[model samples]
Target: MMTAVAQDRLGGPDVLYLTRRERPAPGFGEVLVRVRAASVNPIDAKTRESGAFLGDPPFVLGWDVSGVVEATGPGVRLFRPGDEVYGMPLFPDEAGAYAEYVVAPARHLAPKPAGLTHVEAAALPLAALTARQALVDAARVRPGDRVLVHGAAGGVGHLAVQLAKALGAHVIGTARSAQHPALRDLGADELLDFTEVDVHGAVRDADVVLDTLGGPDAFRALDTLKDGGTLVSLPSPEDDGVIPTAAARGIRAGFMLVQPDPVGLHHLTELVDAGEVRPVVAAGFRLEEVALAHRFAEAGGVLGKTVLTVD
Candidate 1:
């Protein structure tokens, strides 16, 4: 049996409780991982609050997983028992990563980059996937392109800043004044103090803008894009009222609900090995402190990633 941080109800972090269940074994094409670390993302908090994605009571949370393969199921060739691996497991609904062991698809994972510790690798999957998908796949960042990211110092924002720069895009980011220097060091060519500067006023005609802060800002982002430039947000604020404005401006706007991408994970592993993109963790907690971590995540506005050591 192994202990897991679980929640039996849909509510605040206080709902989280510890439970011990039989350690699961891998099925065909899967591997059982002895989890060493897990990173907490905004999705986890929202899911806990709404229970929108989680099943009934007594569900496991957490998406990011970094661990060693303790057992491999039949036909699993990518990794052997005892090999280190990291990946974001099937997220949104079930991942069970905030536990000592989890079973995951072999293809969904890759060799944990030797360059990063388990905590660091654990921090990469969910946020890094969001950044990678938005900056590379959705935004189509190119050499000499200009990119703007909202919430520059936050989990996904910081990674987006660095990933855009790595793609040769000139990146600008918006954050509080206190975080400006940290954003710059993370490869933001320019940092706009959102506390003082108007986002639409200061940024104009970018190739792409990643609006990590969704809601009313969604409508504001449309004005910053040049003709045909894109505004990708986590939520579509004006669903009832946004399309006509985009039609009037000729600027396309849409939301990207990030999904798992194995190829992208493999690529990020390379970036980790090359020292181009490093995981930035603000702090870490043990699995037992998950309730406290969720309370903190619910309070919002943390710099970098917050992680949980599961082992």
Candidate 2:
């Protein structure tokens, strides 16, 4: 048996509770991970409340995991039984990472950076991969390009700032004045206080804009980009009315859903090892305190990621 946080029905954070379940085993090309830590993302909260992408309850809510490989199934070669690894496995599908053990496709994970602890490693996968995919793969950000990140002090936003900088772009970020120094330290070249100033007017001619905050905020970001620039909206869907407006304005706009990418995870590992990128964990709760953790994550105003210690 393995310990896990599960919900029998869809509702608030109160719906979450601890339970015991059969320990999962790896399948073909898969690995069984002894989860040491897992990070809570906004998707987890949304799924918990409304079944977002999950569709129902009686489900485990976590993707980000940092752990030791316990066993390998057929055709696995990337890791051994004792290797330490971290990843956001199965993503929109459930990998059941909020447990003592999880079975994941071997290709969905990468070696945990040696410089980081399990908690820090757990914090990186989903949020960091979102930033990397948006900036590098989707936006195609280039050296000296102007890259603007909305919600720059939040989970995905903070990592986006550092990644844009690492890609050699001049990174601008939107956050409260209180977070300016921290964003600057993370390599953001310009910091805009969204509460104090209008972001559309404050930043202009950005080569790429990562819209971490969806809705009207994504629409507002259109004016901040130069013609032919790319605007990648992370939280919003494609049909949110931003795409047509972007086309009319000679800009490219679309939404991106993060997926499990071992290659991207390796690149992130390189960045972390080289000191170019680091995940900021706002808080951590034990496996039993998942409900409290969910409440904290849903309450917003978090500096970075929230995590759960499975041990």
Candidate 3:
């Protein structure tokens, strides 16, 4: 048996509670991870509150996981029992990472960066992968390219600023003035206080814009991009006319959903090990304090990621 956070019905953070269930075992090409830590993300809270993506009750929230491999099923060769590993497995599905144990497909995970602790590693997967996919895969950011990241101090945005800089792009970030020093230290070439300045006028000719804030903010980001620039919107599934508007402006605009990618995880590991990228942990909570963690994450104004430790 294993202790996991489960909700009988979706409502709010109050719905999350600890319970015991049969310990899961790995199937073919899978690994059973003894979860040491998990991170709370906006998606987790959104899913818990409105069933976003996970359209039902009675589910465990969390995809980011950092731990040791407890067992491996047949055909699994990438990792052995006792190996430290981390990944966002079965994203948009139930990997049940907010538990004592989780079973994940072998290809969905990679070696945990040796330089990072379990808590820091746990903070990387979903948020880092989202930033990596958006900047590297979707935007195809190149050296010398002008990249702008919205919500620069937030989870994915903070990572995006670093990743874009690592990719050789001239990174710009949007956040309140208080976060400017941190964002600049993260390699942002320029910082915009979104509260005080009009983003569209303050910055223009961006080669790529990573929009963590959806809706009108996303539409405004289009104006900041150059004629052939790309805008990758992370939130809001409804197109809501931004696609056609972008087309008319000769810009590329679309939404991107993060997926399980072992390759991306490996790349992140390389960056972390090389000292080029690091996850900023805003707070830590015990596994049983998941409700509090959810509340903290939903409250916003976090500098980086919130983590849940399982001991």
Candidate 3 structure quality by residue, lDDT tens digits, 142-236: 99999999999999999999999999999999999998888899999999888899987889899999999898888888889999889999987
In model 1, the clashing pairs are none
Quality of model 2 by C-alpha lDDT: 0.92
Could you give the C-alpha RMSD of every candidate to the true structure, in order shown? Answer: 1.5, 1.0, 1.0
Model 2 lDDT at residue 300? 71
Q: What is each predicted model's overall lDDT from 0 to 1?
A: 0.85, 0.92, 0.93
Error of 1 at 90 (Å): 0.9
Candidate 3 least-lDDT 10 residues = 235-244
Write down the RMSD of candidate 1 (Cα, Å).
Answer: 1.5
Write the residue-wise lDDT of candidate 1 on 1-311 in tens digits: 99998887888888888899999999999999999999998878877777767756678888899999999999998999889999987766598898999999898788898999999999898899999998888878898988989988888888888898889999989888888877788789988988788988888889898988777787788777787787778743456466578667776677787777889999998887877788888888999999888776656566788999985
- Candidate 1: which stretches are off by over 4 Å? 236-238
Backbone collision count in every prediction? 0, 0, 0
* Candidate 1: C-alpha lDDT: 0.85
